[model samples]
Target: MHVTFPGRHGADPARAVDGVDLDIRPGEIVALVGESGCGKTTLARSLLGLVPPTAGRVTFGGKPLGYSSRALKAYRKRVQLVLQDPSGSLNPRHTVYDAVAEGLRIHGYGGDEQEAVAQALSRAGLRPPERFFLRYPHELSGGQRQRVVIAGALVLEPELIVADEPVASLDASVRGEILALLLRLRAELGLSALVVTHDLGLAWNIADRVAVMYLGRIVETGEVERVLTAPQHPYTRALLSVLPEAPGDPVVLTGEPPDPSRIPSGCRFHARCQILASGEAERAGVADACRGEDLPLLDGGGRAQVACHWARAVRT
Candidate 1:
């Protein structure tokens, strides 16, 4: 899907999601990585039809997404969303059963609602699902509540799920359990997921592919190991350099990312890119190109696609 959102105001960023093209193959998990405000969530919401794109198109199952109520309802059944915060997402008054059964009710599930709800909860790992049926959101632990949220999405038996920072709010240990649950569910159900997160470690833990977003566009994309271990874009490299287990001296980005409203000309990352400022590109005789021309993500015909002049030159 390709998605873009119009600027909030004349002076605000023109597009929250700017000409980003991303694909999630069947049963594949793709992690969308970026700093806060890089439009990761915007792109994810577009897929769910929550955020309407001002430009570009979103197609699922070879069909363009439709905005009509009937169309959206059907689309939602095939593509569910697991939001970042369960507390904010689930209603305090709703019991665990109600939470999971709500989707079934909305979709007019006429057969055995109890059995369907129980199965969804069980699949999400809320063991002895009957035991939690009457429990409200407050009664469950953070992990359990998140499981309930996942259970809600599962009730519809969606083919694809858009998980926006699914584990960001959980404790470190619980984070692993949730991620493991996602993996287990995918393996068993053949579910494709688009995980939006700022946590690169999460990508390393669960995603098959990683797409690094900067400002509003994808700066790099590739297999999980290749993108995390050998990032091609300067922005991606800087993000990895700060990982606790990263080897060698860290590549510290010197300044905050540019304001989306006032994005720099040419390469959006040039102002903060260490490679562009390091004089290596000058020695390689590509400094002018880095500063004078915008670069698109070039497929390296390997495991990665990168959008930086210096990286492309070196790879070629």
Candidate 2:
């Protein structure tokens, strides 16, 4: 999928999501990781139908997404969004009960509204759901507010939840609780999720699979263990190398990611690629290709793949 916007102040159009492909299966969690401005949120928005891709299409249940208001409303019932900030996601005045029931009311649910709200709250790890119904957002703890957000999504009983930085705003201790809640929800509800985050540690802990994004495209992907522990792409390795538990010296990328409006040629990551800079590609006889050959995009399937001329040449 490709999502672009007219460039700022009459510059070229900025490509927020460019030729990216990803999939989320039932009960599975796929983490999309990258630095800020790497287009993770845009990709998630495209899947949520808030931003239509300028090229390609988003599909759910093997069918193409429709942009009609009715179809989108129906799709939203099956796929919900859990935003990054609990403080911003909830209204200051809406009680917990009202907040969770908002989706039900909008969708014109015919079932017992109160019962559904209670079940969703309990499922989201807010046990004894009735006790929190009368409470306001300011009255709850950060973790609790996040739970309420999850409960909002849960109330819809969605097949998939596209969470954008689910725990980034919570306390360190609270992050684990929220993550555990998501894992438990998947186990008990068979729910799938596309978690957009920059924290590789969070992805390593919760995701079944990981896709590393660079600029606007996936540079590497595999099972969490393989991708996090044995990253093949220089970008993935650079990210992991800075973790507290990671071995070796950190790879400090010199500059911010290239502006999407002016993505570099060949490998989008080549300019900052440590492998090429360290002469590894030269030894492998692909240094010239690294500067001139654009690696093929990943098929976005369930297999290990790395989009780097150097990595591919070494593997072959």
Candidate 3:
């Protein structure tokens, strides 16, 4: 889906999310990997109905998402957002019980509120749920606070969870626990998730599939094992190259990321692509295409795909 915003003053509009197609299957997790300003969060917001796409449509269960108040309310019940920071997500005045129950209250759930809250908390790994009911945010550890955030999303029993950097704020010791909790939740609840993160390691740990984003588009996508082990897109390779586990020197990309409002001609990533810089595109006979021909969108699908003219030439 596409989501563009009006430009500041008289400049071109910022194409926050341009021509992106992604799908999430039930009981599966898909990680969106990209730099900070590459429109990962905008895509997440669009999926959750927070921002209406300026050009394309968002579909859920084969139906177009509606923007009406009632429609959005119903949609939100089945899809929830897990923010990056738990401290900011939870209120200092609210106790764990109140925090988790808030979704039920807003949705006007007719079931047993206390029971639902307890069950949600239990699912999020906060065992002996009742013991923490009265505890406030300040009393909880970083991991516990995050669990509470997860519990709040779970309280509504959502079909999908859009977690934006869920463990980015936690200590290295606690990151694994939270990641494990997410995996456990999917296994037990049959929940689907769209995890937006910049960390390839996080994707390796939790996602079944990975979609690499560049500018406002998805440049490459495939099964996690395939994409991580043998990346095709230049951007994806550069990102994985910088990983602590990567071999040799990292492929340090030159120049700043292109501005969305003035996205370059041909491939948006061509400006800083290592393949183009190292004459690989020229060797593959697609150097001109790399600078002049825009490639098709690499729609998230079963098979691996890369939106790069050079890669396409070399593969063919």
lDDT, candidate 1, at 24 = 82
Error of 1 at 133 (Å): 0.2
Error of 1 at 244 (Å): 1.0
Off by over 4 Å in 3: none
Model 2, 133-237: lDDT tens per residue?
999999999999999999999999999999999999999999999999899999998999999999999998899999999899999998999889788899998
Q: Model 3 residue 104 lDDT? A: 98
CA-lDDT, candidates in order = 0.88, 0.94, 0.93
lDDT of 3 by residue, 1-316 (tens): 8899999888899999989988899899999999999999999999999999998899899999999999999999999999999999999999999999999999999999999999999999999999999999999999999999999999999999999999999999999999999999999999999999999999999999999998999999999999999998889998999999998789999998899999999989988988998998998889889898988887767678889898778788
Candidate 1 residues lying further than 4 Å off, grouped into runs, are 1-9, 297-303
Between candidates 1 and 2, the one scoring higher on TM-score is 2
For each candidate in turn, the TM-score is 0.95, 0.99, 0.99
| Candidate 3 weakest ten by summed lDDT | 294-303
User: What is the RMSD, in Å, between candidate 3 and the native fold over all Cα?
Assistant: 0.8
